[model samples]
Target: MSRLRTPTHPTYCRVVRASAWYDLVVTAGFATPWTYVLVHDVLSSGGLALGFEALPELDTWQVLFANLMGSVVVVWAVLRIVRPLPEHGLFDGIARTLFATWQAYALAHGASGLLWLFFGIEVAFGVLQLVPWRWGRNAGSVTNDASPTDGRSDASTYWK
Candidate 1:
């Protein structure tokens, strides 16, 4: 009887783990493109009229790269949330805050109010993404940690 129960437990755990991984993959894939667009749009619009205009082209690439990084982070975060692996709440928080701050800065510096509105929405979404849910803290929150070395966990480590 104990042997049967033990086998069942691991099987159940495997199923649960697989489902969690599937969900995270789906979520990260969905969020990645959206975040890329959001950041790209804000930077393009906000940086279009200044000495920063040249910067937006660079920022476009950066946004793409950042989105990729973010997607990886999101996957790891989902896993951590599902499995309760090493706690990354503090770090995720900081990331979200930095995203928000960047959006706000873009809004403030942009040439047009419309750009500001766009940045504002990005800021809001960035904040929402960081909100703690059943899956664990949002990936952005990991940025809040003061220890730079400890804060630098590879976004993909959680998947392993």
Candidate 2:
């Protein structure tokens, strides 16, 4: 049957759009640190210092992992931008777990301030990720127009 439906509440659509934009901004913001660190490492032979003593070893791995995670997040964020939530659910969960690990590592390594900031941002994104787009087949607002029939919605399908 071909079904025609209208949103119960229009504000929910705005919320979904705003949430997606927030995710995009957060993803881009996360990438900034990686870029800054990379440039610092390249420009300064002494390497980037986090207001502490020489941490060449720690810095190397941390920067590498941060860059890799940032790249992954950017891709996920693009998927979210195109498809909205609940589409990349599993990938979002994995990203959140990895972000938690990264936060813990930063805390243990004496970057608690930075860790707390990242933790806060990640928490917000994680909460958004858990939002249900389809609830009990009632058709939640966010996923209503999202279908594999469109190319944009297919971004996260590959991960599933």
Candidate 3:
């Protein structure tokens, strides 16, 4: 470690990077099934079914639209994994929390049990990202450096 004392701990960045990689894996798994699930009910024989059962019959176009959306998520996950940005954590956390709430709502409306597990995970992820973003150390503060303008050793320029 460089021994630069910043508000955000050094380890926090690693954790965020790891989380981004996890997200990448998860999204890839989901994206891999997008076309297959959109066209065929592959899990019907394995005692499991995902997505809306009535969706296929109700509107074929809707399934295609959902598949396209999944592709977008996959791309975003790849970007996050390749270049983790802690500054964007709060927005991502808020989005995950919203998704979890929606999943809970779906479960309440008699959705599948798998969504329950996803809801828990989404909520946990949201908390993990949000907590560090809000309560962890702030970045870009120097305790040892002096400001040229003020001629003081204890100088801090904080950015959120």
Clash list (residue pairs), candidate 3 = 7-137, 8-137
**Local distance difference test scores for all models:** 0.45, 0.51, 0.54
Candidate 2 lowest-lDDT run of ten:
1-10
Better of 2 and 3 by lDDT: 3
Q: Pick the winner on TM-score between candidates 2 and 3.
A: 3
Alpha-carbon runs more than 4 Å astray in model 3: 1-7, 29-34, 38-59, 135-160
Candidate 2 residue-wise lDDT at 115: 45
Could you tell me how far off, in angstroms, the CA of residue 54 lies in candidate 3 after the best superposition? 11
Over 66-144, each residue of candidate 1 has an lDDT whose tens digit, in order, gives 6676677667657645653223332443454675577667756764444454445434433433343233234433332
- Candidate 1 regions with alpha-carbon error over 4 angstroms: 1-63, 111-160
Error of 2 at 106 (Å): 3.5
Ranked by lDDT, the better of candidates 1 and 2 is 2
Candidate number with the higher TM-score (1 or 2)? 2
- What's the lDDT of the predicted structure labeled candidate 3? 0.54
Model 2: runs farther than 4 Å from truth? 1-34, 38-60, 131-160
